[model samples]
Target: MLEMKLTITAPDLSAAINNLAQTMSARVPGLQNGTSTCAEATNTTSVGADAVPAANPIQVTGVPTSAVPVAPAPTSVPVEQTAPVPTAAPAYTLEMIATAGTALIDAGKMKLLTDLIARYGISSITELDPSQYGAFATELRTLGAQI
Candidate 1:
């Protein structure tokens, strides 16, 4: 014999029971007239049936209790999915190069900065796109290293 507590939340309680009964009828071996009453059987897992209260006890028979699938309460499922990791921004950006250049210019390399802008054939730093920023920053660093 097996016993388990069931806290069912069906909108139509009788319909749920009927549906359960039909499903159980197919699975269990000794159901009389292809049906069972709430009292005729009890959940098979009841090691200590007397100690347990039966506010809404599910009656199961003719199957191992461990074979039964117990549905956990809705609250047990995690409502909030784990947030996806935020994507990191690209390391090279036009604004970052511009800012880095500004610091270099303040250190007395305004002419060198202007020379770099002319080498790229761009009238101003604004003419360079984000894609060009990495190469330009690399060239600028190489130029600084030479000096």
Candidate 2:
């Protein structure tokens, strides 16, 4: 009669167990489908009468009975891209318009300013809508006002 005992280290246990399962599956018919009556194991291992040698029954200690498959890493990672935000032009202020109007008046171009304002159906600068300030500013610029 002969006896043998093999001890596996903690780090090597996983690899050892995998190799053992492959060997057992090949040797034992019932272990091929990962099931047996001798002992229960998760995903890979199974034990039965034919799984163990008559002279030496293998024993595994301090190891998890389950085998978890690791997922493969992605071939290429996706990168998120963002478009640049459009910057809005500054809104024209009433004070800006007043400065331009005062400049035109001081330059003796009050008629030109008044005529420009009148073209927009407005008799006075105060009567002008805030939204029309941009167009008014552009006109005042053409009339030589430092708006």
By summed lDDT, the worst window of 10 consecutive residues in model 2 runs over: 37-46
Q: Which candidate number has the best lDDT?
A: 2
**Clash totals for all candidate models:** 10, 0
lDDT of 2: 0.68
**Cα distance off (Å), candidate 1, residue 87:** 16
Estimate the lDDT of model 1.
0.65
Q: Tell me the tens digit of each residue's lDDT in model 2 across 22-139.
A: 6666655444445222222222222443344333234543233434247888698778888978597558898999998999999999889889988999888888899889888989
Question: TM-scores, in order shown?
Answer: 0.35, 0.40
**Residue range 27-132, candidate 1, lDDT tens digits:** 7666543443344223333334654454456554343455467997677656887998869633676767777788778778888888899998998889987677
RMSD of each: 14.1, 15.6
lDDT of each: 0.65, 0.68
Q: Candidate 1: which pairs clash? A: 1-44, 2-43, 2-44, 2-45, 2-46, 3-43, 3-44, 3-45, 3-46, 42-60
